[model samples]
Target: MEKLLGEFSIGLFFWQTVLFLALLFLLRKFAWKPILNAVNDREEGIKNALDSAEQAKREMENLQADNQKLLKEARAEREEMLKEAREIKNKMIDDAKEEAREEAGKLIAQAQASIQTEKKAAIAELKSQVANLSIEIAEKVVREELSNKDKQVKLVESMLGEATLN
Candidate 1:
């Protein structure tokens, strides 16, 4: 115990102090700068990552807005197409009705014309029949009057006297 206590002296204390200071200098020169640089780099990487996340979020919002706008445009275009189709359908129906009316008018006119032609033909036939009957009656009367020879001679002398007076 006496020798152990005696071994603790100022020379050992001085050597220990020198060794501690040298180790501190070596560590400061080799290790401290690298450790601080590593910490700064990690901080910078974290900041960049956060900024990238914010930018991506903004881009997503813009994309969503664009999608909504496109959807509205598509709906409007579809409505317009539906309206046009309805208009076309109405026009076609109107055209069909007009065509039907025109065809009916033509048919009526043709029927009226045919009736008029038939009536005229009937009237003409009646007139011809009346003329034929009149001619037959006159021929019969003339034949009966001429059947008597004395009456025919008196008729001939009266006719000749009327002719001389004319």
Candidate 2:
């Protein structure tokens, strides 16, 4: 039993040593370099992804700032346009008022001129009527006063001469 145990112990020790050496060689040849390269590649990939994220974040911030600037400029332009519109509206109103005043003055002047012409025509008609009435009154008075035929003829001749002199 001792011999059997001793031989088994020796065989197990030799096999364990051989297996250890073979495992060391396999790790060096196949496992160690690939694992280290995989770790390095993973780290480089993480770093590149972080850099790309930072760049995108900066670009987004710049875009946000540009948008704000554009918004402000648009508001300013709107304000300026509104101010110009108001000024133009005021000027138009003033011009319209001036035109209305001028038209009113012209209308008043025309009305006054029309009134003056009517007044002159009315006065001329009245003067003509008065002159005709005066001539009629004079003829009736003279016909009543001069009844004798010869005296009537002489008085009419003398009155005609006096009228011509006057």
Candidate 3:
């Protein structure tokens, strides 16, 4: 310790101080300036990247909302179409039933008319047959009575008597 203190010289110390100050000046000019600039540029790039990420997140949220809205609209449209189809189906069934009822009514009316016409024709034929039978029976009875001359004469005499009294 005593030798180090004894060797400490003011001229050597002054020269060392000058050299240290020169080196510090050169380092500040060449190395520190570039290092600080690089750090500032890195900070700006990170900030820009964070801002872009935030914007992208906002855009993604907006797109999700739009997709949800579109899905809801599609569901509503599908339900509406189904409802309309069901209504159309029911209407078609009702129309078919009504047409069937009309056709049945027409067929029934035609059958009833045909039956009435047949009944009238049958009644007319029966009347004609009965009249022909009655005429034939009366002719036979007249021929038999005429064959018996005495009976025919008595029948004629009675008819004459009744006529004269009236």
Candidate 4:
């Protein structure tokens, strides 16, 4: 070991050490700076991408909430519309029923009035026929009782004169 160390010069070791240190310094100044800057830029880009992804996730959640709210409002509106339609339908049905009842009552009243008129007409005709039949029967009975022609002629003349005076 001592022989090997003695063969090499102290000046040669010093020159080699200085050359290695200068190469290291030059690499750090030029190559290492650019490489480090590129690495740092890549890291910043990754962080920005992560932040954008997180923002997109939050936006999606907000959109989902808005969609849910819109869906609920649509359902509520549909329910309200259905309720209103049912009410209107019921009202229309009731109105139609009432109209039918009114028409039926009118028809019944007309039938009753017609029946009453016919009954009154029949009664009047029956009374007139009865009166005429009573008159005929009285004439037949008087004719049957008066057998004498001269007495019947005198009775008829007096009845006619009394009727004319009245």
Candidates in order, TM-scores: namely 0.59, 0.59, 0.63, 0.66
Model 2, 1-166: lDDT tens digits are: 9988767876778999999999988997899889999999999999999999999999999999999999999999999999999999999999999999999999999999999999899999898888788778867876776676887888788888988985
- In model 4, residue pairs whose N, Cα or C atoms come closer than 3 Å (at least 3 residues apart or on different chains), thus clashing, are none
**How many backbone clashes does every candidate have?**
0, 0, 0, 0
Task: Please tell me which model should have the higher lDDT, number 2 or number 3.
Answer: 3
Candidate 2 is scored at a TM of: 0.59
Candidate 4 Cα misplacement greater than 4 A, ranges: 1-25, 142-166
Model 2's alpha-carbon lDDT is 0.91
Runs off by more than 4 Å, candidate 2: 1-28, 130-166
**Tens-digit lDDT string for candidate 3 (4-80):** 99999999999999999999999999999999999999999999999999999999999999999999999999999
Off by over 4 Å in 1: 1-32, 127-166
Which scores higher on lDDT, 3 or 4?
A: 4
Estimate candidate 3's alpha-carbon lDDT, on a 0 to 1 scale: 0.92
lDDT of each: 0.90, 0.91, 0.92, 0.93
Candidate 1 has a TM-score of: 0.59
At residue 148, candidate 2 shows an lDDT of 68
Distance from true location, Cα of 51 in model 3, Å: 1.5
Of the candidates shown, which would achieve the greatest TM-score relative to the real structure?
4
Ranking by lDDT: 4, 3, 2, 1
